[model samples]
Target: MASRSTLLKLTFVVAMVLAVVVLPPPADAAISCSQVLGYLRPCIGYVTGSVPGKVPPAVCCTGIKSLNSAAKVTPDRQAVCRCLKQLANGFGSGPVNRAGAVPGKCGVNIPFKISLSTDCSKVR
Candidate 1:
């Protein structure tokens, strides 16, 4: 006894529900690449050896610490790793890809290596 319009509306609703349930979740649902890059910007100069310093500056360390804290989950860590790899690739053959030392010098421990060869899929 349902009217045609009522049945169409019901079908639409059901289809929407099915789509929501069937679709895979977003890859970086928890973390964003922009966020990962934003947190590491302060350390870029020090990390790339473009700036003269025996150690990373306090601001650089602070940024690294914040990045480390934000990447607590596996997905977030993987996102960070991916972002670092992307940045490294953009840097060409320059030494700007020396991000691995920043974390250690800054005393912040990241869950994954920042090297270009680091397998982000295995970050967990």
Candidate 2:
């Protein structure tokens, strides 16, 4: 017969193996920037000033609202702010200024300014 200590060690090892195999992997704690961008893509025309009207469409506001809702945590909010800054850089100053104004125009209360100069790391 196995010694008590030996049996205990074997039981611990089996339990650990079982836990690894049976338990699901932990879910990601933060949302990806790509996902946030996907939601905001529809607002590009309005944000860029490419569209004739200054007013953003209802769909654009919906997307902004959805993005606002998803970025609940500090990390997620920071990620979103970084992504927006990147997008602003890609859009150039003219469009970026307009883009920054989009949230307020749509009545969406964003935590950080969506400007190219925004320091995303400092976003709360």
lDDT (CA) for every model shown? Answer: 0.81, 0.85
Candidate 2: stretches off by over 4 Å: 1-10, 13-28
What would you estimate as the lDDT of candidate 2? Answer: 0.85
Model 2 per-residue lDDT tens digits across residues 1-124: 9999999999999999999999999854776878887889889988777766868888888999999998898888988987887777777788888888888988999999878778888888
Distance (Å) between predicted and true CA of 98, model 1? Answer: 2.7
Native-referenced Cα lDDT, model 1: 0.81
Task: Give candidate 2's error at residue 3 in angstroms.
Answer: 9.1
Q: Quick one: best TM-score, which candidate?
A: 2
Candidate 1 local lDDT, 24-48, one digit each (tens): 8776675777897788778778767
